[model samples]
Target: MTGRRRWTTDEILGTAAELLRTSDAESFSVRKLAAALGTDSSSLYRHFRNKTELLRAVADRTLEAAMDGYRPPDGWKERLTATALRLREAFGQHPQVAAIWGRYGSGGPGSRLVMEEVLQALRASGLPDEEIPARYHRVVILVTALIASEAGVGALLPEEYEQGMEQFRVAVLGADPDRFPALSHFAREIRPLGVDRRAAFDEIIAAHLAQIEIAIP
Candidate 1:
C-alpha cells in the first residue's frame, strides 16, 4: 500500500482556494479541505492555527497571484494604475478569495509584498514623506473597497445577483431627470461611454490619480 502524500503550503493553499470556489463559504470546513487533499485535518492544522488563519493565508495567496508578472511602470501614476487594474482582474478571477479579503481586510506575507510594491510607487509619486503613511492607507482603501464592492456579488445566487444588478440599473438609469440631473446625464451618455465595468473602473482610477497628481510636489 502507498504511504500518505505530504503537501506543501502552496499545494495546500491552491487546493483550499479551489475548494473555496466550489463550496459554500459559510459551510466550508477543514474536513472538506482535508478530504480534497487526501489528508486529515491534523495536517492542515499544523500549517494553520485554525480555519480563519487558513482563510487569511489563502487571501494572501490570492494577492500573490495578483502581483505575479506585474511590472511597475516608469511613472508613478502609471505604476499605480497598472497595480489597481491588476488587482481588479485578480478579484474578478478569484471571487472567493476576494470575498474573504473584503471581509478580513488584512493580509500576510503576500499582502505585505503587494503593499511594499504599492508603497514604492507612492514614494515615486513625490509625495512628502510625512504624508506617505496616510496616502498609502488611502490608496489601499480606495483600491480594495472598489474591488470588494463589485466582488461582493460573487457569493450570491445567479438569480438574486442579477436582480441586484437590475435594481442598480433601474434605480440609477431610471431616476428622475430633473432631480438627479447628473445621473440622468450619465445615463444618457453611458451607452456610448461604455457602461461596462471597465469604464467605471477607469473613471474611478482616473479620479484617484487626479487627486494624487494634485497633491504631488
Candidate 2:
C-alpha cells in the first residue's frame, strides 16, 4: 500500500492562496483547505497551529511572490517606486490576499523585507532622523489607502459597478459650463479615466516622489 503523501509548508500556503482566489474569506476554513488538498485537517495542523496562522502564512507568501524578481535600483526614488509598484500589482493580482494582509499586519519575513527596503530608501532621502518615522508611515498609509479604495470598488458586482460609473459619467457630462467650467471642459476626458485606479496609483506615486525630491535638498 502507498504511504500517505506529505506536504511542505510552501505547498500548503500556495494551495491555500489558490483556494482563496475563488473562495470568500468568510467561508474558508482548514477543513476546506484540507479537502482541497485531499487530506484531513489533522494533517494540516502539523504545519500550522491553527486556521489563523495558516491564513497569515498564505498572506506572507503572497508578499514574497510580489517581490519575487525584485532587485534594488540605483537611486532611492527608483528603489522606492519599484517596490511600491510591485506591491500594487500584487494586491491587484491577489485581492483576497490583500484583504487578509490588511487585516493582519503580521511581520513575517516578506513584510520585513518591504519595510526594510522602504526605510532604507527613506534614509537615503536625507530626511531628518526624527522625521523618517513619520514619513515612512505616511508613505505606507498613502499607498494602502489608495490601493484599498481600488480594491473596494473591485469587490462590487460587475453590473453594479458599471451602473455607478454610468451615473457618475452622466453627472459629469451634464454639468453646466459656466457653473462648473473645469468639470465641463474636461468631462469627456474624465469619463474614461475617472474610475481608473491604475492611473490614480501612478499619478499619486509620482506626486509623492516629487515631494520627496523637493525635500532631498
Candidate 3:
C-alpha cells in the first residue's frame, strides 16, 4: 500500500501565513488551520512545539516576504528609503504581521540581515564604524514606530476627527485672540500641517542622511 504524504513545515507555515493575511490572526486556530490543510490539529505540533512558536515562525516568514527582492541602490539614502518603503508595503499588506514584529527582539535573521545591510550602507556613506550601529538602530526604531502606529490605529478615522480638531483650534483662538495671537494669526497653518506621510518619510530620510554627512567630517 502507498503511504500518505505528509505536509512539510514550509507548507504549514505558508498556509498559516496566507490565513493570517486573509483573516484576523486572532481568528486563526490550529483546528481551522488543520481543516484548511485537510489534516488534524495535532500534526502541526510536530513541526512547531506550540502555538506561540508557530506564530513566531509565521512572523519570520512574513518578514522574509517583506525583505524579498530588496536590492540596495548606489546611494545610501536611496537604499534606506527603498528598504523602509519595502518594509512598509509588506506590513501594510499584512498588518497582522506588524503586531508581533515589535514584540520580538530585533534579532530575527531576516530583520538582522536587513539591518546589517543598512549599517553597511551607512558606513559606505561616510558614517564612522563606531556610530553605524547606533544610527542603524535609530533608523530601524523610527521606521518600525511608523509601521506600528499604522497597524495599531489603522487607516480608519471618524469623519469628525479632523473636523473636530479644526473646530477646537478655531474656537480656542477665537475665544482668546490676544491670548493666542500666533495661533489665531496662523490658524490654518497651525491645524496639524496635513502632511502626507510619504512626504514625511522622505523628509525624515533626508534629514538622517544630512546628519550622517555632518557627522562624517
> What lDDT score goes with residue 206 in model 2?
80
- C-alpha TM-score for every candidate: 0.84, 0.81, 0.73
**By TM-score: ranked, best first:** 1, 2, 3
Evaluate residue 183 in candidate 3 and report its C-alpha lDDT on the 0 to 100 scale. 69
The 10 consecutive residues of candidate 1 with the worst lDDT sum are 188-197
Q: By lDDT, highest first, what's the ranking?
A: 1, 2, 3
- Angstrom error of the Cα, residue 121, model 1: value is 1.1
Q: What is the C-alpha RMSD of each candidate to the true structure, in Å?
A: 3.5, 3.3, 4.5
Each prediction's Cα lDDT score?
0.82, 0.81, 0.72
What stretches of model 3 exceed 4 Å from their correct place?
1-5, 22-28, 105-108, 153-195
Error of 1 at 117 (Å): 1.4
TM-score of predicted structure 2: 0.81
Model 1 TM: 0.84
